[model samples]
Target: MGNILNSVILESILLDEGETLYKQNEASAYDLADDNGYAYHKVAAWVKGKDGTKYIKTASIASRAQLGKVNVSVTGKGAAGLYEIDSEFYTVGENVPDPESIRNNSYCYSEVNNVLVSNAIYRSGFANLDFRLSTGLPLKQYFNNDGELNEATIQKVKNSLKPLAKTAVSENPPIMREHLIYAESLSAFVDWMVDENGEMVNKVSNGVLVVDVGGGTTDISFINSANEIYMPGSDTVKTGVLDVFKKLKQYLSSAYEIDEEHIRVDMLDKALRTNKFTVRGESKDCEGLCNKAKQHVAKRLNNFIDELVTTTLDHIIFVGGGAEALREQLL
Candidate 1:
């Protein structure tokens, strides 16, 4: 085992070629940090290393996603959770691309690259890493509509990822071994279920609802009074922050005559925060238009959340990347 840097338990487990099975564990935030838990954006972009080798760069901060690119090409996101078993490759960038992938496919090198990028960036340049891995799935992807395990999808996800454990992604990628995959939403709940000593807590005596509005998907999950996940009420919705970005980008396109692709993620963020944008070197106010765009997406999300909110829930928690962006409208 290695020292915990992020929220991951870094143990080495070189599996036999035929032994690619994964074991699931309900890990808490304390356990996460004790095991090297590090939070990173789901976005991964392709860039060249010093030796001209291709590498996938993942950013803990959203701005890093477009670090070197003149234009931020939207790719790989929203393709998550419903991975198709095929040989299709998604383009990472239209300019100076990487051959491997930009697709957010857990079953492919893209997933491996994301992990590698994390290890490289957050590891403080410490090399010779030999850590086993653990990842997660959204609520709908982890469970079926009947509240039972999505056996087929889970198995497929694990099986496909097994071979990549030892597969090299970069010239000096971290040494990865076997790994675990947990339910993304449930992982959040486990944080509340454990104490600072990594022991169980008694705080979860009532029902709680978790709303995770992410960049690509919004997951709604419920925990009953018994501290069990109400599978029937747990699901992943397709509406997320990316949709909000689309509406914002659309407004920028139509109102400012700026191409949607050229807006870039960072530029849009600045515009949203300051309610102003630059055109021909002059700052222009877009406060009203920006609010209108966010409100439109928030309205749609409210319609879906209305059905999920009920009188039985004792506490409601809002989370994920998008939650703060639409904070005023959502809360």
Candidate 2:
């Protein structure tokens, strides 16, 4: 067993819908280093005159080509009565060109699988690697009914991922073995109670409520002093940071009469943070627009939080990407 262990590398991957995070066995246990997680995106551009052309390109951060493979497929209409070819790829730090493209059922599987294999291989020093991965599902997604993960649904997710894992692993020099993916939260409860060592931070006989604002959804639940995970019970709202971005996109599209694709994710963020932004050398201000959108989302969140009367609680916690954004408004 020792020899076998030495022969193959072990890796734990957090397969987030919005991001992919992983840590290798060589790293200290529970230590998430800076290089661990990555934003998920694939920027594939169609090559003109190419039909069904596909190739995976790898590169280091210092090198330009690390964006993975460029896949060319005959899709949509082309210029001047010719069938057009389309390709998509992604680079780190760049806003996703089309959020809907990745959110749908058809295009996402390949993107996730390719990135998983590419990232694993990159970490393994381009060697054939056997990976044991760990991932999380949204509390509401896996436990939609009765606040518990359904057995059949869990099995379905696992089974669907297995083949994707195999295909990704085999694509590069590193091949993956078996892997594991699971799902977390109660943000304040996570920090205040759960320690890095998986031990309790403090023992108390009090109830705590946790609210986590995420990218696509916000989850709410409760935990008692006895460490029993309870809820109002647990529930989720469909409002999140992405929703805000979508609304901003809509506003920009209507106001400027520009194609929605031209509005990058970063642009929305910039417009929100700084009231003014420029397009084609023209400066525009969107303070009123962004404020209205923020107010709309805040109202939804406020309504959800208002329904919480689940047992008297000693504390309440708010966390996740959307938490900070809504903090002042929520308070």
Candidate 3:
């Protein structure tokens, strides 16, 4: 009984007014989140045909399939007398968990996308089960502009998850006993600092800044010398490497007269890597343009980071999907 989550860290962090966020709760008494519920994967639609044909995909399978949503109906927000999600259809393709939208405080585990994700995971197991679910918010939103804990948002997360049932190509899967939420960058920091035993490792006793670069937003979390978060230093920036993908698509459109929708994210990534853009089934070198697009977005991210971080910090860690791509350009 040394740490609340001796198992999950590898963690959970909660902070209040002017206090350090590195919390330690009752040891061995923590609710561990199921990895399937919290993993970031390219999920495909769970499709069901009239002849009882069914398809459930997640991770590489979903990414390979290139579909991320399924039409669903959630019934009655089922707690405190309500049943579950509303009985209306949640539009199919509109639920992609875009990083920029999440930073803007518009996404969460309670969303229909998560429900679909949960359902797919549950159905694949084909067994009755109960598990904890965890999610994160952008660093800046986790702590409001005043550096105070955003209780309202936290409560909103808890409230909106009101026991709901979702049907997406299948009946609602009975699972998810608990829901845990934390800040995006802060979660990164905790994972970096602790081990499976919840013991500190790779110690950074002084200020350490954690940067989480995702698809469309970058979240920054900094813990100062006093062991407390420096709120003024934390932020959720709109700049990210995916911006380069969009810019490149636009570049290809102007150069090749191709529709933007016709080019997918995977194609743009390959093009930037190989310096080739395929148009009309022909590959063309576009290295110079690719570098320009990458640099433009990377520079915007660097500018914000330069202003936020100081030389006095003990460490600066860069993580997330965008980190390695922008590493060559970052300070």
lDDT of candidates 1 onward, in order: 0.52, 0.49, 0.56
Q: Any idea what lDDT model 2 has?
A: 0.49
Judge candidate 3 at residue 245 and give its lDDT: 80
Indicate whether candidate 1 or candidate 3 has the larger lDDT.
3
Q: Which stretches of candidate 1 lie over 4 Å from their true place?
A: 1-59, 62-127, 159-172, 199-202
Q: Give the per-residue lDDT digits (tens) of candidate 1, residues 1-331.
A: 1332222213212212232222233231101111111122342223344555544344332212211213322463232111111222222221322122222424222343343334322332212334445556678777777778878877776565433311112223344444566677676677767864789874655578888776667778889888888766666777776676668888888988887767866566678779998976889998887888889988888888777666566667777667777888884
Using TM-score, give the best candidate's number: 3
- Candidates' TM-scores? 0.63, 0.61, 0.66
Q: Which candidate number has the best lDDT? A: 3
Ordered by lDDT, highest first, the candidates read 3, 1, 2
Query: 258-331 in candidate 3: lDDT tens per residue?
Result: 88878766677778768998878888998877878888888888889889876577788888667766677777
Q: Which is better, 1 or 2, measured by TM-score?
A: 1
Q: What's the lDDT for residue 87 in model 1?
A: 28
Model 1, global lDDT: 0.52
| lDDT pick, better of 2 and 3 | 3
Runs of candidate 2 exceeding 4 Å displacement: 1-93, 101-129, 163-178, 186-188, 203-206, 254-261, 273-276, 283-288
Model 3 residue 102 lDDT? 26
